[model samples]
Target: MKVLLYAEAKRLLSRSGIGIALKHQMEALKRVNVDFTLAIDDDYDLAHINTVGPGARFVANSCRSKNIPIIWHVHTTAEDIRNSFLLSNIYSKYAKFALRKIYSKADFLVFPTRYTMNIVRKYGVKVEGEVVSNGVDTQFFKKNEEKARQFRRKYGLTGPIVLCVALPFKRKGIHDFVDVAKRLSQCHFVWIGSKGLASLLPRDVREILRNPPSNVLFPGFMPQEELVGAYSAADVFFFPSYEENEGIVVLEALSCECPVLVRDIPVYEDWLQDGVNCLKGKTNTDFEKAIEKLISDKNFANELGKMARKVALERDLTIIGEKLKRIYEEVLEKHGKKDE
Candidate 1:
């Protein structure tokens, strides 16, 4: 059973979550021994697309004509896309309409979380769909003391480290992160993301990026290897994202045994427990308290980190690969194509 896997605007979205998810999916498929091709082939049994653009629309139409099942991975919704860049909110209405139309063409829609599924349904996406997390590679993100030391040395960072891995967007709580940095002047705060797309950012967000707090460091776009080291070195992973489909970095931090403190968003309801594997905060005050608690209670923080690692193991790529294989088999079976 050969599959055609495609992601629209692959080059443009290289630093984005959508692109990262697509790359992970490809790796998972490879690990599961799923036969796939980047380009469309006449003998392909299915076409799995991960974006809604002109090229994606063409692929969907072609698949429909050939009676090949099309699976659409829902990575972003109009709601989540809002506040992500300059004029993103203004374009959200059109994005929703386009999403509804494109999703209707799919034989099935794959949502990374139930929260995302609910969002799409609320926006009138009436299509068959299922939830599947974009799992992390535990082996790659595992804690390494030496690597962590190197990462810390490179940045000349000392004291407790507070980290957040996200794009430079206001909706990601970048402003809130700055506020937290100001409130906790003693802790070294590092935000690993891109600032090169400043033109796409709103004026306020761009201004904040240009002038961050002295304690805050925006070590823009680290490669995965270095990122894993940062994850390991960080004392706490503080993510105050106002919105998210499913924050993949949370899983990576957990995989590296880093205690995480995230915003209390619907996306994390199923996977995160306030005092179990992670700490959830609603307001800046709550976030400050959570960070202070983690900092003061090393034993409690370590316990949570251990539990978080357990959670990461459950969502490892090997396990996710099995889930994907099952989904592929089921989709093919429904289309009268035997898995064998």
Candidate 2:
């Protein structure tokens, strides 16, 4: 069956995780040989919508009118949107109300993690939900010695590198990242994200960027090819986000076999195990110690990296494609019966 794959604000989201997830969904469908089109006007048996904006609402309404099955991929939640940009908390309040109304219209919902599914259910969205990871392309993100070397040289980076890939938002724990960087002056702390949106950042977040520690560097957004090298060149991939539906960067880092350290948040409860595949920390102090441990003990770091790659293998694109194909068939079959 042909599917209409749609994402609103594609240009604005291209630098963010939601955009990366959407791209992964397209690639996964391709791997499974599913026929899909990005155009909203394209004729299709089913629609998989990736955003909750006005455009997404129009698409959902259109699919409803035509009796076409709709799969709403819930990538954003009010809880995760708060503390991000200027007035994000204010927007989140209204966003929750709008999301419930929009999501309730879905034939089914796809969530990046069970954590997100549970939270959305609490938001009064009773639509049937399936947990599908924002899978990574292990083949594309794997470590390359030449690329790693080039990345380091291009940036004039020296010493152990502590990398964090995220937008310049408060909720992403940028303040905490900077605090941790101050504690470890020996390591080079590189935050790879979009600086173009710095104007929209919260006042405190913008202030932090203005007077960051000498060891810290904001290299702005990097291309996907450069990101592969960033992960490979990093001594550790440190993510301290306050909330996430699913962290796609974590999977990318794991796929590259880079040792990862993340916040002890609910979204990671199922897949990430502290001192196992990766390390977890709840505070800046905890993160500082974890980074130090990973950097000092090379053998331990390598072991964690190896195990992390195994975890990435389970959520690889090929596997996610098979899951999506089954999901599509189930939705189509159910919709057909209802139509009859």
Residue-level lDDT for 206 in candidate 2? 84
lDDT of each: 0.90, 0.92
Candidate 2 residue runs with Cα over 4 Å from true position: 337-340
Q: Model 1, range 1-340, lDDT digits (tens) per residue? A: 8888888778888888988888888889899999888786557889989888899899999999988899999986888888888788989878888888889898889998999999889878888889989999999989899999999999999899999999988889999999999999999999999777889888898788788889999989889999988998988999999889989999999999999999998999988999999999999999999999999999999999999999999989988878888888999999888976
Q: In candidate 2, what are the lDDT values of residues 1-340, reduced to their tens digit?
A: 8988899989999999889988998999999998899998888889999998889999999888989999999998999889988888999988888889989999999999999999899889999979999899999999888899999999998799999999988888898899899889999999999988889987788888888899999988999999999999999999999999989999999999999999999999988899999999988889989999999999999999999999999999999999988898899998873211
Estimate the TM-score for candidate 2: 0.98
Error of 1 at 87 (Å): 0.7
TM-score each candidate: 0.97, 0.98
State model 2's lDDT.
0.92
**Candidate 1 Cα misplacement greater than 4 A, ranges:** 41-43
- RMSD of candidates 1 onward, in order: 1.2, 1.6
**lDDT for residue 102 in candidate 2, whole number 0-100:** 89
